[model samples]
Target: MIRHLVLFKLNEGVSRDEERVVAGVKAFQELDGVVPELTFWECAWNITDRPIAHDFAINSAVADRDALTRYLEHPAHQAAAARWREFATWVIADYEF
Candidate 1:
């Protein structure tokens, strides 16, 4: 399996609450339904007083390299990227075995 993780820095005008960010991340559940290769997806955000993560981070598990490739090029992913690009300053992603 491939473990995919990403940390994001949100744009200046975007809100930075943990629950709201988690809600946004939960939206990936829908993508999993549409894109079969994604075995798991989850995200969390930093808190106001207690930062749980750096900015925003996503953790996903996929079947293999091909599955990861499929997830990356999927239309559902593109839509998700477009949604995130609107309020993200920058994003860092990594994949592991």
Candidate 2:
């Protein structure tokens, strides 16, 4: 399986509770039902106050690289990512499990 993890940092002045941010989060949360390639999906806001901690995270798994690709290309994921791009930057790590 491929484990796909991501940490998102909100842009300066962007609040996690902002309407658009909340909607974007919801969009990602809704992806598990829409993407067939996903074997696992978990996402949440981070509560830590540490400087190195990101504002949110996503932990997901798929069968392999191809499945991961399909998940990335899914319309719902693209839409959610685009929304996030307006107010945040993210880092991702993908590894075989």
> Best by TM-score, which number?
2
Tell me the alpha-carbon RMSD of every candidate.
Answer: 3.7, 0.5
TM-score of every prediction relative to native: 0.71, 0.98
Clashes of each: 0, 0
lDDT of 2 by residue, 1-97 (tens): 9999999999999998899999999999999779999999999999889999999999999999999999999998999999999999999999998
TM-score of 1: 0.71
What C-alpha lDDT, on a 0 to 100 scale, does residue 55 get in candidate 1?
74
Question: Which segments of model 2 are wrong by more than 4 Å?
Answer: none
lDDT of 2: 0.95
Model 1, CA-based lDDT: 0.71
